[model samples]
Target: MSDNYTKIVQQNLHKLYTKLPPDLERNLPGHRNGQEFMFNAFGEKCTITPRAITLGDANYPAIHGILISLYALNATPEICLLSPFKSFREFPDSMPYVGAFTTHTEQLLEPHVPDIRKSAALITRYFNGEDVPVQGGGDFAFTLFPLPKIALCYIFYEADEDFPASVKCLFSNNANRFLPIDGLADVGEYTSKKIVDLICDVNSPS
Candidate 1:
């Protein structure tokens, strides 16, 4: 079971929620979770609203508003269920960049879909100290960039001989490649570099 990780994350976020205005609190009890958390707020019980932060792109910037929404869900559970929420002024600094995505990313969506399950298995084996290389993992790294956007990122490592089986990974807007389970720090760096190269290549006339 996922244990409603979003809800659990919301619970954790409440402990640190701050800077909420009285009127906004009254308007929309205030949420501190992700997009879903804030969407849960709306209606007669609340009436406060603040402008959303700029997330480079409009429409689907879950990372932009997730922090504030998570807090609202945790701190003001009662009035949060008002109408569709429209405030994200109190977003936090440490909220993860991955947990609050608002939509399917075209950044790395299509190309990476098929790799998810296979890579997951490799991650499991490597983290386990099994020395298993993720399929498609070349001598360098597997820089699998999907279509749309790269909304989610993670790695699975199975327990190894010397170390307990523990999948250690983190989501990063920066990781362009995957680190081989054998030894490496990251995997997404290669993918990102390639993306940059492609951009530069197109721009370079010569």
Candidate 2:
């Protein structure tokens, strides 16, 4: 299933790339040297060329597929402010992916509770390298531009005496312009997992 998804993503990327205007490509937020598109993904520098997409020095197939798909489909390079943290149901066409994010968050993030400090630390480190500013929301809050036009705000609320730690992922009001609700969900899941893995890596013994 994952391999199929990657193939589909790649096909869509190619189709979209062919239709994209040259003026739009020039204005894209990343470092575009000729036909290549470049940007920071997590802490790694990603370059998207006509033949292949690479993350740092290695070929990252899945990430390349998703990111390039998003870039090709992106409507504009203009960014908007972070919207209020809300459930997926609050956004039109986003209700379908709510269950996936909910399940992932409950099973992975909620169980950690007060240990949200680790998640917070990982986010700080990730964004710090990208030069993206992270501001306080609950326990930790930051706005990330996974693509130049796509902005996602992640807020982690620390556990209190009565409740467990909870996470809220919100997107810019204009998110639907770039990708569909399902694609947004994939982005959310991918981002959450990346942070979780980073935290685990930090805790692991070398």
The numbered model that scores best in TM-score is 2
State the lDDT of candidate 2 residue by residue for 21-67, as single tens digits: 57655445567787777776545676766555667665453754765
129-182: candidate 1 lDDT, tens digit per residue: 122233322221221222111211333333348644222122324212211111
Query: Candidate 2, overall lDDT?
Result: 0.62
Candidate 1: segments with Cα more than 4 A from true spot: 1-92, 95-148, 172-206
lDDT of each: 0.28, 0.62
- Root mean square deviation (Cα) for candidate 1: 18.0
